[model samples]
Target: MPMPEQADAAKSRAPSPAVDRGLTVIERLVTADEEMTLTALAKATRIPLATCASIVYTLEQRGYAARRVVGRSHFWRPTLRLYGLASQLVRKIDLSSVAQPELRALADAVDMPAHIGVLDGATVVYVAKAATAGFIQFDTYPGKVSPFNLTALGRAIAAYLPEDELAPLLTGLVGGRGPAAGDGSAAAFRELLETVRSRGYAVEDQEEQAEVACVAAPFFDAEGRVAGAVGVTGFARDLVDERRDKAAAGVRQVAATVSQRLGCPATALPRPETVF
Candidate 1:
């Protein structure tokens, strides 16, 4: 047993139990597939009911979490505040800065319009674009966003997603009436995902933009998370057979180069097709 003074001093220096409880609650709600109730959160964190309630109230006040009341029981879950903050961090990333050279090289190698895009909700947002020197290419530009199921860029990222995560995404995209919604149902969607995974890239042949063809490959970050994707777009006729295959190889090569620069292991590289 220690003296009262010593025990009190040590307790004062420790981290706030309230803050620890709050953070643990946030993590639990964020990772949960379904909403959790106040009792559940308190039990999961082993925090006293009153303290958990107070922390949850504070989070709600800050718009970081929300609750749904059903009769006497209330369910709580994290809100999109984290996602909004994440987007702010993404803006600071300057993906185009490091990826410009690769984008340009891809455009030159593929002789088409090249773009780097990141997944934004159910859409893909183009952040960088390059065109073959002196060659006119139309339709895609920086800041443009397209439905995930309709763009090769989006599908590339989707290919690497776990089934649990991918199912809801594809279902949501379909619910939004994306152009590809008419193509098939759940089974067909699964097949599309399977094809993309097997090939190491996603191919869209005149699927989104009329007479336009595209191939895209996803790139990983230092932690091996899919950071974004690189893609080449061109006319349908120009993207057939050897041409399409070659472009796929080029896209994978450039994405791999960038991924490597970001510290991704060579073993993790997804090479769809070998250069002929």
Candidate 2:
């Protein structure tokens, strides 16, 4: 038998030239600004033209790349199947771990507690948080669940969901047990979602607790889908009126950072009137 180090080195080497060539073609298609013809792919990857044609044909058959024919020429580009596979892997990532650093930074910047939450049916479940020192701690922790319409974190994500998905969540929301809860009609809630989309963030001014409020913004995954949200919670007095804009900006910035880390393109992020 070979020595252990040699065996390890052998295991690390490319095992299949055909598979390597196929992956190279796929990468070239994915990174190219425009579709490439077979000749271009062969030249770029330095594979024989016949070999490159076979690789691309296999990729096309497997739904990883697509072909477009113009007149007699065939051009190829990557398909969303690759993105779908990537999104599946992204979904398995520990979202709380990904957002924790940004959550801490947001808490320190806003001098309040910050949280990250994901949607669970019609509710938002807090999965991680960063608490500030010297503040009266709010009654919230990881695993806390709140109605989607009653918290800024929830609203931030809900606002970006498709209408078909949001409609079911809005069905039974009728003025929950919050001091500031009001106008739970679907029409009113739809209007609120529109505002969230327009402003690039959501606010719950004393909607969950009599003395507390939150400002939040949605984060996205590589597929441009709402993955979760990041929010800061503070006394209602500190999060409204003159102070609200600063807090909202901080929350949006954290959301943007976390979303980018999750593979969301910068262009896919929300652009409120106030640039981040």
Candidate 3:
């Protein structure tokens, strides 16, 4: 169907045969209607039996696949723990006992998943979390260390600190780039933190993960330091458009409450725009 020169050009532009064959094996495993044996995988992928076995071995080592131990041989299955690790990190941050009762009240009042987060080096760690009572809810536990640039909770805390105070905190923390914090992947975070300072609250839409949104406000201590933040996150479909403001209000109220509990007076509450 093609001219000889055109056919030659297409062949030259194509991926190496070994690379294409390897990818084909992976694609077949991903789209299979049923569990595939090494023989079946090799046949479907048009790869050698030894090569297919080697690919499976590599996938298993990386936690992408696991042996099911079906019959006399092993069947590969995907491990879900990779996804659960994110939640586990959030659950590890430590919150004081005094903060729990207020966190519980805020969680119960909003009927949404809520968490208390504090700065831990360069990351914001979830010190505590309360799951909603509803049948469907965002599931988070204490001690999760969410990416600072990617979460409303982190942004809210970033919003209130003085630029000098916060900049070094950001630059000194893990993944920070010294004085030039925005030189690398942290540029987005630097920009977002600036926006959070301009806005009254931090709002996130599908930043941490696709289809999840959140709103957060920061808590300040009597000394005027950024102590922590409280935020709510849920399915994006449930909290789209007009609902964002309500979530932001809730976050502000809870953050204010936590600040008051930490001995910050009503008059001392730092406005989002004033970084003092």
Candidate 4:
């Protein structure tokens, strides 16, 4: 019962139904486990078949979706255009800001100090940290830099690097220092990285500091490359056997969450069982 002018104004401000249906179709295609036929997409979106076809065809023209012919039917799937836009948005965000809340959650869950670190040359630099209340804290800070082989955070990130990139880092660290417990030589360090890769997580058991231990897992970027690592540090006596396993699982889960937020596909992440 409104005036004609008022009704026209309201209609003009409303969202476009066509745009909404087009987005719905795109989302359905993107989330489908396999390429969807136009019929399947229409059924999933509850849009009419001809309308869905038009929407998909428009998407294909815009480089957002691709069509494949299988048998007698055509199947549609989302292209990398959406992923490229997502990658650009993620690149503009800060890694530490994205990881801070997850680190805090990890600290509370494990009752220890949790941290995020990034590889810098031959060292790993801590960029953010969260400590549980009433817990004994370690002598670490945001800017603390430790040799790559001496910390779980470093090992977690290094384990995923290609040999061509890892060899130089190992050479620099081992050749410039005396034999250490975890990194005695380049060969030994390579062996350790192999173990870390197999397990999907890394552990530092009193290797760097007395009575201190840490567990960490790597998180990747949209390009499926290791971007950084998340770790929890505590007393070695407290992080043993079952406790260590639990902490390792927690760290892996948190890292996976951060990776997904950074536009990494779920398929690219390590399986949960691999952490154990």
Largest TM-score belongs to which candidate? 2
Name every residue pair that clashes in candidate 2: none
Where does the lowest 10-residue lDDT sum fall in candidate 4?
Answer: 174-183
Steric clash count of candidate 3: 12
Off by over 4 Å in 4: 1-91, 174-183, 273-276
In terms of lDDT, model 1 sits at 0.81
- Rank candidates by TM-score, best first: 2, 4, 1, 3
Q: How far does residue 64 in candidate 3 sit from its true spot (Å)?
A: 62
Per-residue CA lDDT of candidate 4, range 1-276, in tens?
999999998888988899999999988888899999998899999999999999999999999999999799998999999999887896787777786777787888888898889999989999888978884668878899999888899999999998788878977763322223554687888888899999999998877767888999999987799999999999888999888888998899889988998879999887663332
lDDT per model vs. reference: 0.81, 0.86, 0.70, 0.86
Q: TM-score for every candidate vs. truth? A: 0.62, 0.71, 0.54, 0.66
Off by over 4 Å in 1: 1-93, 133-135, 174-182, 271-276
**Where does candidate 3 have its weakest 10-residue lDDT segment?**
175-184
Q: Taking the tens digit of each residue's C-alpha lDDT, what string does model 1 give over 169-231?
A: 866653333233345466776788789878888888765656787899989985688888889
Report the error of model 1 at residue 20, Å: 32
TM-score comparison, 1 vs 3, better candidate: 1
RMSD of each: 10.9, 8.4, 22.3, 9.0
C-alpha lDDT (0 to 100) for residue 86 of candidate 2: 84
